[model samples]
Target: MHTTTSDTAPEQRTAAPRHPVARAGRISAQGAAALVLVLLLLVVVRLPWAGDLGMHAATVERLRHGLLHPGNPLIDADTPSPYYSPWTLLLGIVAKLTGLSVFVVLRLGALAGLALLVTGVHRYVRTLTAHRAAPALALLSLLFLWGPALFSWSGFLGLNSLALTVSYPSVCALGLTFHFWAWLTRAARGPIGWGAGAGLGVLWAVILLCHQFTGVVATLGGLAMVAGARPARATLLRLGTGLLPGLLVLWLWPYYDFFALFSAGGDLEAVHRSLYRDLAGRFGYVLLGVVALGFRLRRDRRDPLALFFALGVLMVAAGGLTGHYSWGRALPAALIPAQLAAALQAVSAGRWALRRGWACVLLVALVAGAWTQAGTLGYVVRRDALPGAVAAKYREPWAGYQWIVRAGVRYGDVVMARRFPARQIPAYGPYTVAPGYPDVFLPDADRREAAMKRYFEAGTGDGERRAILRAYGARWVVGGAPAPWLHKTAVGPRGQVLYRVAP
Candidate 1:
């Protein structure tokens, strides 16, 4: 299939329009991007509590104290974990050398991740179109092209989601994924040397290790880039040759077993089932991008964006049908190409009438999207201080387990708490009786969870509860109920009490 001029262009041939309206629109998009970037910077400094923040923070804390043999992040177990990726290891090193708190290191990581994401988006979009506005427009589209319903997940690049998970390795992996695509697009156009190919392969593996779900999205995007290029036999050979070292890195990584995650899918399906819920409410706005993708398909039978969208769709659909709901994490692979296509089409459409129509439609969709996620403002601003309208949109963050930590919980001390508190307690350097999140590598996670449950059960005798605490060596407990074996030490913001387990 013949490539479109927009795709093959080495640089933007047309000077930016001097028309007042066009200039204004470009300025508006760029301004919106700048504002969102500033908001994200504030969010990083604030580091609001949300999904997996504690898990990630705990991982960094463990690594800071003991990089070589950092045990399971959430519980008192000497087991390897998937959380100790290259990204976290680097942050851990920084924390150790600088004597920075784990949260401070996380703030730095968030800044780096946000920077990578911005630069990567600009570079990748430039490959798709020469329009000067394409980069800014694409960035805005990626952030605001979803449906009116609010949705936030690690790999999903929606503005609201990015604000919540800016510190996560998933964000860093996604940033690298964009840069990978841009580099691959350039290399596939001509001969690639062995060194470049091998380096590319290593980068790919690093992304997977950082965040396995985003890694799948990266793979799909990379395949789309390669398939669309139809590279020469020698180019293909070099690419395949480079892949070996990358696979080796995955196999040899001492932190965790990268390959074991495939068999571990059964453990994750339950937690990920929500990825399939309210699909239309969460992603319906992407139909505009889908329409734009249709245009690209009509122009080039093997358009990279179309191929990327198809591959993502196939994966997500198979997941929903085959009961492998975890594959829903690959939703970004489908959403991203369509979003970019819409942004590119707005500027590159051949006819003036077509361009005007598409741009206007996109503007409306983006405005609606921004409004839907207005609650994100609460991350940096006080909810009570925000305007009533914005306050209503806000979803409050967790108050955290600092109250427990402040009362003198120390590293490696196991605390018995139910699930919610279990999630946050470890962030402050203590372990919970049960792992707050799924732990594929922890051998006794299930038994630990059952013990925690039985301890809290109304019918359980004090003897069994004490046995449970002793079995896990739990030194503290977070609950309201009083027991003869518990000595209350501190009360939490939500009225939960911290108790020292009597010896």
Candidate 2:
């Protein structure tokens, strides 16, 4: 029988490897539980969409149609907008391919980005240490960090803000940058290839497309990675060459205008002030966590984790001073991965350095963290549970603007409104307000603001109104209270009236 089995042939002695799905199905209960925990965390962490989220959705929706590219829908519809990022382009493509509404696509896409970011951070932490608790601790640091989960002046709290509060482009950019760094870190340990170098360049370019500010942060982190590795000239050359595509994209698209806006004194001081205010309560905890982790890492200069965190902090500081609000806002996205690695190491070291009884207390603290996280998630969902809660919060009195869109206000029509800003209305209607808030940088912004002021004056006579309207070229007025001078064209769904300017 043994002879017969040997005669069967060498090939028959070994069975083909099981399909990945079959292997995956054989995962232990612990692995399965971990998977469930991750999935739950994804849902809990992603907050409801609001404000800029809606605007971004509307931008993508427009792009999906004949609009082709992104524009400030609330501003001059014809003029290019800074919203023309790789994220919007990808959202449009996904919507088209899946036949899903851009709104739905945006939500799902953001969720996917969140998932990618968490997984990338988890993998990176594991790479830093063999301690089993380190990975979970990393996640706990993120979940338990004292940050705004709903809305901040910059967006949402912590790293979640990038994916949820801010534009999806930033979220995707964060995820891409994290994955790229993770890959770069691994490749640095081995002999790198031309393919990886090219890939890094291409990835860098894509990050630029997603968000120029994020691109800057990625460059900083990537340089830190390279410095740590001290890679050969060929690798560095390839990385440099890879940036060409991104630079070309910047030249060809909205970045040219984006830089111009920032350079032209784009109310940067105000943005900087706002960013500082947001950072006050939110970032301090993250900094402390990173510091704790850094101390545990032996403060090694060559450590990639330390370098990455340091570079991230430097980039954030530079961004703040330079009036790069998005850069400053998105800096956390880059730092979170490193912060997690540090946290894991720090926590693991603490467990080892302490007595067994103290270890039990650490376990208790982790369980408490899990419980608190669940409660926090519950509070977040409950607070914004009502239908249109976010819309009511941000859109405010302009929640009725959709009626104007339904009433078929001319596309790109410039209307004067007291409540909703021009940019905010674009999410609900095809029309633009005369001169809304100074959110987006527009050419002739000073003149528009002045004209808007005159139009809203209590003593503004018909002649003055006409002159103001003529100056701003706005034909319609969306107001709450009826005006004797205005000829009512149509009543909106919410009983708000649209009036034609009587010359």
Candidate 3:
């Protein structure tokens, strides 16, 4: 009897190793964030949206009038340049065929890409979240999206900021980033894993043609991870093989460096003073939060993949600090992992708060605040933030040109305008313009300005507009609300205006 107590076996405990799917799938941070993403997406779907409207005006002007792009010649020719992507041109072609507004095409395309981005982000967070996070994760996902992707191209500074924005044929490179990072972290499954990588390579190539900045940043991100392990050549080859097609597409502009293209210039210091300040200021916070997070997740952070979330956050902070503090370019690339982590933490915190009582209120408050902010941001971007008009116009500039061609004028007649690009004439309609400024397509800015200016001045006379008409073969003069230069003929409701010259 006495021996029985001493010899008694301590309770036998066994745990089946958690299946990743079961772990990730069973209610996670990602699910919480994804819920918000879906909600925001639904709102983004319906809209009379516009952003970067002027760019579309410019692009459509060229396409509708068949004017060549004065700046870059590669787009005008069938042989694409590595610097110039065929995607926008193809979009223009499709818009012409479909009779959709160039803005419409672009806005719709961006919207679609955004939807996918949210889904991908949700998955990204799910891949990274360490435990069952459905409820909290769903909320966190919503919060993170509003701050990053949803607002990437919206508000004061966001993604799709036309200046830093890039696109390929039908995709926005940034939109697919979640999936790109997600795959690297996911336990590589069969064809699905391979497929994701292959697909990413294709999308990344398109990203280069569309928005080289984000693409470069993303590459930097992935490269940082790759350098750590110095993985086998086979893995590298797989990534390269999948990328070959896009690489060939990108090589279209061989003149742009295959290397040094992404390097910060020598004056990285002065070129972006504000960015540096912002980045430096945020560095403390970024380091504090991300590194602390690295520790918080240390028990589960055994995998190489975890570094991505932390690294992504830090890199974004770096971008904000170094570049012009462009939210699209600097923030999202790094915030990506942070966002994913936040969602998981929120959910984890939520469950803890529920169990722990009032002391957890502060923790839960942070979670709630973060989630609400994300949802609110998403709602804002979806409802009003994105210059949908601006984005569409930038994506397709043919709309701007259609006004010029539709003028009740004869063929072979020219239009007088200011700062109108001359290259898109061929794509737009049977029209021609003089003084191809910014004719990088031909040579350099000097050549472009010289040629365009000569053509512009030839037809104008102070005493008589007729002399100018005769010189440039102009049959009509046109202008729009956005173009204040044209006096006599201003654009109407249809976005066109025409002035009669000497017959």
Highest TM-score among the candidates is held by which one?
1
Candidate 1 ranges beyond 4 A from true positions: 1-15
Screening candidate 2 with a backbone cut-off below 3 angstroms (N, C-alpha, C), the clashing residue pairs are none
Alpha-carbon TM-score of each model against the true structure: 0.97, 0.74, 0.56
Q: What is the C-alpha lDDT of each candidate?
A: 0.90, 0.55, 0.42
lDDT by residue for model 2 (1-503), tens: 11111211222232212445323322432253365345444543443444465467656766665446545546564566666666777777787778886557766776776666667655555445544445555655554443332323322224333323433676667667767776765555445666776677777777776766666767776776666655556655665666665566556664236455455455645545565565544444455546544653475556555676777777667767776654565555444644465344333433333423433443344343333233333323444553453324332212435566666566666778763445455655354544344545567666666677667777777677777766666767876345666788888655667887666
Model 3 misplaced stretches (Cα beyond 4 Å):
1-101, 130-171, 187-200, 224-237, 240-246, 252-292, 296-331, 348-487, 491-503
Q: How far off is model 1, as Cα RMSD?
A: 1.8
Candidate 3: Cα lDDT at 136 = 44
TM-score for predicted model 2 compared with the true structure? 0.74
Q: What tens-digit string does per-residue lDDT give for candidate 3 at 1-503? A: 10111111111011212546435544443465455445444534432223333343335434433423323221222221223344455555666678786556655555655655556655554544433443344334333233212222421112223112222222355555556655543412112245555766776666666556556546655664444324445555566566776676666644343444444343333433444443433322223234334644564443333555545556656656555343334454454444444434333433343323421332353343443233333333443444544333223222335454554544344555444434333223323344332222333334334433553464544444445446546555554222222345435445545555545
